[model samples]
Target chain A: MRCAKRNTILLLALLLTFAAWTSAQDEAPYYQSADFNVPIIAGWQNQSANEAAQFHKPAASATIRAAMATGADAEAAAAADLASWLGLAELTAPVYRGKVNLADGTWHVLARDIDAQRSVSQVARQAGDRFIVISFLESDPSSRIVMLAIAQADETLETAEPEMDSALEQLTGLRLDNLTAAQARALPGGEWLVYQSETALVAGSLFGNDSYIALQEGTAGDLAALADAWRGTLLGFFITPDNSPYLWLGITVSLLILAALAGSFAWRARALQKDLAMIEQLEKADAR
Target chain B: MTQHEAENPLAVRPQPRLLRALTIVSALGFAGTLVLGLFVAGTDIQQGQVQRIFYIHMPSFFGAFTAFGATVLGGIIYLWRGSEAWDRIALAGVEVGLAFALINLLTGSIWARPIWNTWWTWDPRLTSAAVMCLTYAAYLMLRAGIENPQRRRSLMSVYGIFAFISVLLTLFIIRIVPDTIHPVIVGASPQNAQGAFEATSGVVVALLPSLLLWLTLMPITLMWHRYRLALRQEAVDALKLKLLGA
Candidate 1:
């Protein structure tokens, strides 16, 4: 009777412990909507009238760099200014051959005629200047040119010029002054047209756009560098995806633990059976 | 001889001390399992809090299977060696297995309610587990209907061995074929595409202890209960002999 009472007390204690453990295992919420975002730009589009026949091909490419360069303070500021205008908190300014700014939420830039024989579209726009360039690249060739009106800045061009130059230098290796654009009559296939701010420029292409040659003109080393920077940014966001990885690990471990427990019980049953057999044999011997 | 004397030929058998010790240990182990289980957090990447139910559901199923396995093994031994001890152990194991299986089914349904968006599913694993539970239940009912102890033990032992084979088929069939209905968790598959696994150090710390306790406690408790049952049978036999003229 004493042994039975002790067993009962132990059973009660075990039950209490189990209840406490289960309550502690209660789950907590880990996913939130703010953890992920759908990227807006699926891919880039190049619009060049000379390559009208093969406009569907890849037209241009631009090198994307971090805004944290040693001399990129000026470029970073200008990128920040543009980003602010667009209501984007996180923005990385890419170096384009032309001066670009947010014009009523749309990117607008003006290119001046660098060569006397070349048209205004052939030359990249310089920093801190205003000029007339109303051609907008539409994916549909049949669509009419939508002339975008440039809005006058509240500040003078002289004050914004230095800031824009610094921002461009900081973001892209080439200073805003060195940026230039050129028009080629070949199909848009191989040329890399980079749209950094709002302004798009034709850099160079491998095959004409008609042939669908997607090669962009750049040293392999430079492409690798740009890819590295993009990868770094992506890594930061991977840790905090809407479905966090930590939670998955927890569930897996729990399953393994349960399996182990089952195995242990099976082992114990075997041991107990041996003991029971011995006791039964002893009882039978006493009866004999 | 009286009916009681005829029933149990050995009524004065002494209970073993080892059995009592196991009972104490098992009770303590069970307590520890419950405490640890409650404290561990059940967070999952995709299912959120609903995933915590996995811990309880899985262990219960595992415990039930373990008990069932013991029952079959005990039944085999009882038939081969013709030992009453094996018969008693088989009976106890089956009873405990049934209890745990019932708990497993209930907890699994509770878990499925929030995650699978339903209270019950006819998924292969769930169906098989249910069938296995019902079959054993039938085994118990059949035993109760019989009055002859020797016949009842022999039939139950045979049925227990057969039921174990059914359990094996139930557990392995879904693994052999693609189960389109119920999603697989933990293993690599499309079911894992939704990202429903995660384990942190804190969760491991809490769950491991609980599992250890359950593993230690289950067998000890079951064996103790079986011994007590045997003792009660002996007591009934002796009392009947005292009342009847031999």
Candidate 2:
């Protein structure tokens, strides 16, 4: 009977764990608007958010680093600044002669033949100084670097391109307002945001030799919520429970040790009780 | 089997004096390892000061490997001879081995970040190690969920023997597989590894004994304590049965 009871409990525990794992897997990929709303592409997981929100996709398996600028001319200013950096460094790499303008009117700076099989691209824009820079390089599979391997192993830049575009579009659409350092720091995603000053909200993600940055500006409430939602969307994928098994193992072991000690003490007490009762009974008989 | 015997169980099994001495020695040895690893070891030629993490990383891994191996040996003895002592050893080995395994994984991650530039990757070596850690944790959980003593011991013995496969896989996966980015310092890797290095004489001096002494002392100390605890629990169970029978 005891064995049967124990087995049932064990079975129930296994089922409950399975159920929880399933539910975490099934959670919607969309981040509902509490402070702000963002829908992360499926297969991504959020790692951190502050100055920049780091989103990693397990399938395309690339990390997207985002920062924001809510200043007056965010997109155009960011683009010109990046263009200047690219111009200076362009001569060192195998360069393509002309710039390719995207359908969204943003220009792309592509560095051709960086290695035998890889290229680097940076896209940036500014209206006044509300600028965001999204940069990535084609990861070569034969690269010795692990980060490059992860970026290039099976993840094609083509698959990640759409996700990047969507992120840029959402970021570009926001209206940013200036916040004091204290105000910015007080926000929910304050610590994770890229720049925590009164001017620009910039976040940067650096992987291997490449970096991706996003800038946004707006009300402190909206800025915090947006950063947090993007973080949630990117890091939403479930691989395992956050709680470590070692934690449960430690608890179980400690309890078992305590129970073992207590059981021995209890048994010794029972034996003493039995001996006292026997002595009293013998003494009563002797008196008679 | 009498009331006197029941009242005085520890009299039959005197506490081992060696346990205390071993505990003290192991504590002092560990302190020495920390001091030597931190202050005595020279900066690595390739990895700089961060390479110091290798001292604890290597020893803890070897310690975990040895503990798991001991668990296998204990399991085999229990299955063949059916001695409760052997079963106790198996239980003790897994618990102690598991602690070391965690240290190995944590320290490995700390080492990987600056060198590999990533906290974790699903390379064969790392993946296999993670699986090994999970398997042993399941072993403990399996023991905990069972109520029947004989069945618990029998099943754990078999599982303990089987679980060593993952440990072997963790150790050898990088050697066998060509695609892994994990560094193989002692032997050849088909692919270039960013963090592979030659261990200097200073590293060898600190590493070899740390591995041997920790593998010898840490598990022995933990196993001794667990063995005694198991014995006491067994005595209590026997007393309960005697009381009912009387």
> TM-scores across all candidates?
0.47, 0.47
Each predicted complex: what DockQ? 0.03, 0.02
Among these predictions, the greatest DockQ belongs to 1
Candidate 2 C-alpha lDDT tens digits along A1-288? 999999999995776465445534544343322122234444457653443334554433234433333434433333343345335343233232223333223333332334444333333433233444443333333320011101222233422223222333343432222223322223332233333444334443322222233333332223333334333332231112122233333334433543453364456555644654554455456558
Docking quality band of candidate 2, CAPRI definitions: incorrect
The regions of model 1 sitting more than 4 angstroms off are A1-288, B1-21, B40-42, B180-207, B241-246
**Candidate 2 wrongly placed segments (more than 4 Å):** A1-288, B1-14, B243-246
lDDT of 1 by residue, B23-108 (tens): 66765665555444444453343455545555555666666677788888889998898887888788777777776676667666
